[model samples]
Target: MIFPTQYSMLSTEALKSYLEEAYGLNNLGCKLLIHNVSDTYLLAGVDDKYIFKLYRDSHRKLDEIKAEVELLNILKENGAKISYPVTDLKGGQIQSFNAAEGIRNGVLFSFAEGKPTHDYYDSRLQTIGREMAHIHNITADIELQNPRKVYDVRTTLIQPLEYIKSEFTELPEEYAWLQSTTEKVVEKIRHFDLSKFSYGYCHYDFLPHNFHFDEHDNITFFDFDFAGKGLLANDMMTFYVHFFFQVMLKKQSQEEADKNFQTFISAYRQVRAVSEEELAAIPYLGFAFWVFFLEFYQLHFEDWSNTFYNLRFKKERMGWIRNWVEWYCRF
Candidate 1:
């Protein structure tokens, strides 16, 4: 049987039992944090805290999950402030259990203190840019123990078009236009000069929400579930589009978004040199990211009757996609 987000909820008592028995932690309270791609639970412990992430069996393969664990460890060793995975009593990083949806996997992580935000000052954005570059520089030489999915056109573009077409026999009038636009974007970016571009594992979802900052203005990035091998420029584009969306959502002007983008890119350039050729390919990559992001949500959540998933809301979301894609594609 399918479950919501392909995972089951754990009671506080059950969570405590699991932690005490396997991970050897005192879970004073367990609260379901968020359910986006996975069911993340906040496991409160005595004098400390931790995050319990239950992987949706259908979301990622075992190897990919293992890769994520290893990636985090490498980043931590290399001086990135990452929330590393905690091993169980059996000295295993992953724990599998049968849920209604089927057998699912879970991992424990040390809670990274501080709250994430969509807004940040120039100094904070500068810090984020440098920190992200540090991640790329450090992980450039480290090899993963297990393989993870590589971000590319087939995984991000064409497959999404096919999935949407197959899933819905009748779609909005603009759906066809979206498909063709995605195809054009794919064709345009099919041949890019990788010599000037940096390619490595990315936080893929390197947005403001996935990060938090302490009082010293130090930032910590979490939720690397979407992390994988891809163009570093794509990560930068993803960051741009997210802030751009915020601009649209808040009814702010493009001028504000432009400033934010420049602030981010300028700071990023200081840490990692981005050539004109690679930076030129960023717009189309942003468009492709728009498609992949949309497909990710649509494919995962089939039902849209909820307030945020209603027909009108879906249309509004598509509108944002259309506008954002056009906005960047124009330049």
Candidate 2:
């Protein structure tokens, strides 16, 4: 389904062979344990750790990955606890390899030990909020060269609409509704004055899966593959839309949703206060995120539906967009 290139290409035997060749482990009695996280490859051995990210799409460039590594290195240098990119003995930021499938570009990194933030307490959310603010503060002054813009709501919606219209046939009724809804949302988004919002480099996708928390409640952010220049409000809104709206609010009552939103916003505002104007923009951003979700799901639905595990959840996958649009209009 969501098979990343590295995971699909490198099997257990292949990993062992590669490690044995790369690290001269032929004589040494060691085993390579490969961890298959969604969309990335991670391997752990007796005394070594490495993360391998496969270049699945052409949207990301090698230079952009280098920029992300530099940004993380800078964050670590500034006292933020993060996984630093590991260089080979010959000193290189990134290592390139040619597999039979395609060019697999990757950077090795030492693993940062922690669990995902979902297992942590609500107090830990406050700590995460503060730490995220600190990260933003540190990065605000550092100017990046030729940074690409992360995929936003507008592009996410429009691109897929064109794709579905051109490629897909025998349209399902629900998909037809999605297409119509996207057009309406696009009109609303275009009317909004986006120039009034503040823009900066941000971690475009900050979900619980992308963050880690230690025993002491220290939060470390990771997965900068989607990081880029964008509106800070949209960045924050993306997190809210993913965690609260999609995960929690969808399953619970409106009262529960409002409570959780207040908690997150309160904690976030303690470090950086969002203005009234930005607060008003949250609903529109939420609507945009709905479009984004629909587009992403439409692109991946076929592959995902074919997978054994993902097939079970296929029916519920793209149903949230309608409720999201309704909520946005009411708000």
Candidate 3:
């Protein structure tokens, strides 16, 4: 709901037509899923069930979206566990249309069954780790036909700050403090010798919500909306940063945090090697992304026009971000 002027949820009628026009399916039912990053609609008809995604803010280009679909196919073909994209009637995987904002593209994906993990456990952490390793193993070698963004210090850290400045012509003192802290954090990030580390396709957003577990406990990774080229270790660090802070927010013990980290790292190493140096840099990388996320919510949602700015909604988040930063800098 942040950028309503630039983005709107896809209506049922339009969503159905999109499915029909692209995949030649009719009488499909549509349900609006969450609206963030993209507007996703769940569609169902007779024997067909699919999840349709409409890119928001036109943040991604058509070729970038195609690269995601292609990567999904590549991972599946290589025997990596993933929910692949469904081809349209024209054998095309993406459907682009002119909307109010501009040209928007949508893709039909086979529904991934199973609930997103909310209760953190070591076993689930290990599962996510192993699957990501499997994905990186194949994605590293495969050459993508379409281009994707690269996740690096510039993209993940500096660009977010630049976007913030664009939105807030005059930075608040809190925002100014954040800027100074971010630069110091960026310096810490620069210390990492990325040349010797793992590199290739990183699931820039490997948060737990992007994948689901089936009845057999097998994970089917979906939502490559943020897929891009980068250091694979960065993917692990992203998850590490997110999961750690989430647990801290819940008042969980360090033991619980340590257990999840140990299991996840150990399981990933079972499938692929992570060097000691890469392991050490995880906390720094995690902090970099953590700062990036804080800047993201502020830049995107702090204005009165953004519903996310409502005091009640943003209060706890600011507290959490502050505490996380203090803890990170202290350690």
Best by lDDT: 1
- Cand. 3 TM to true fold: 0.86
lDDT of the structure predicted as candidate 3: 0.75
lDDT score for candidate 1 against the true structure: 0.76
* Model 3 stretches astray by more than 4 angstroms: 1-5, 24-27, 120-122, 166-173, 298-305, 310-318, 328-331
Report, for every candidate in turn, its global Cα lDDT versus the true structure.
Answer: 0.76, 0.61, 0.75
Q: In model 3, which residue pairs have backbone atoms overlapping below 3 Å?
A: none
Off by over 4 Å in 2: 1-8, 11-39, 45-48, 57-59, 117-120, 139-143, 166-176, 242-252, 293-315
Per TM-score, the best of the predicted structures is: 1
TM-scores of the models, in the order given: 0.89, 0.76, 0.86
List the candidate numbers ranked by lDDT, top first. Answer: 1, 3, 2
lDDT of 2 by residue, 1-331 (tens): 4433532344546654554455444532323333222235566666665565545334356777778888888888887766677765556656565654456566656576777854434687677666766677676668776565565554666765665453334346656776777677667656667676656677767777777777877676777776777667766676666555544345656766566656666787787766667766666666665555445555554433134324334335445656556665532
How many pairs of residues collide in each model? 1, 0, 0
- lDDT per residue as tens, model 1, 33-55: 77667778887756888898888
What's model 2's lDDT at 261? 59
Which scores higher on lDDT, 1 or 2?
1
Model 1: weakest 10-residue lDDT segment is: 302-311
